[model samples]
Target: MAAVSLSVSTVKPLGDRIFIKVSEAEAKTAGGILLPDNAQEKPQVGEVTAVGPGKRSDDGTRQELDVKVGDKVLYSKYAGTEVKLAGEEYILLSEKDILAVVA
Candidate 1:
């Protein structure tokens, strides 16, 4: 038998959470000089690729998620857990960590 691999192009996070792919860091600044890899700040914006089933509140009701898949979101500079899927890097975070959904 041949080895089989499963390609998960999509994932569903659970409970007030979401999955996003971090944007690439800027390679240069307006000063016209290239910045070192470490000099660039970690990107805070990313495109939402997956969403979770809303969380349950104490009231016995589920809180609805605000962001949807394909929405560009801005998150905190120091939030989310880094993970790898299908050989691609991704982040799993709670919706609360998301600062804003890009208009």
Candidate 2:
């Protein structure tokens, strides 16, 4: 089998799915205490990298998504599939999984 190569530019989401670049987990506490790698929680925030066209409507039309590329957003903690490309962590999830735009 031939090996496949994946890159951010080569990926496209179908339906209402979205691709996001995960933010780095905090390495230290607010009190200036250093935390271990395993002690940090998975970040629920990220920047939208790619987005699907839209979800299909009952009349075969496409419903536009509220979020757009480069928007910083917060999502459900357990939602989305984790992926790594070029050593960068990312998540592919449905638009519903996104809780809010971070402003």
lDDT of all predictions: 0.85, 0.98
Expressed as tens digits, the lDDT of each residue in 1-103 for candidate 1 is 9975634364668899898988888899988889998899888998998888899999989989998889999999889998776776678999889999898
**lDDT at residue 82 of model 1 (Cα atoms):** 83
Query: How many Å off is the CA of 74 in candidate 1?
Result: 0.5
Q: Lowest-lDDT window of 10 residues in candidate 2?
A: 27-36
Model 2 pairs in collision: none
The CA lDDT at 80 in model 2 is 92
Per-model TM values vs. the true structure: 0.84, 0.98
lDDT of 2 at 18: 97
In order, what is each prediction's RMSD in angstroms? 2.9, 0.5
Question: How much is the lDDT of residue 53 in candidate 2?
Answer: 99
CA shift of 36, model 1, Å: 2.2
Global lDDT for candidate 2? Answer: 0.98
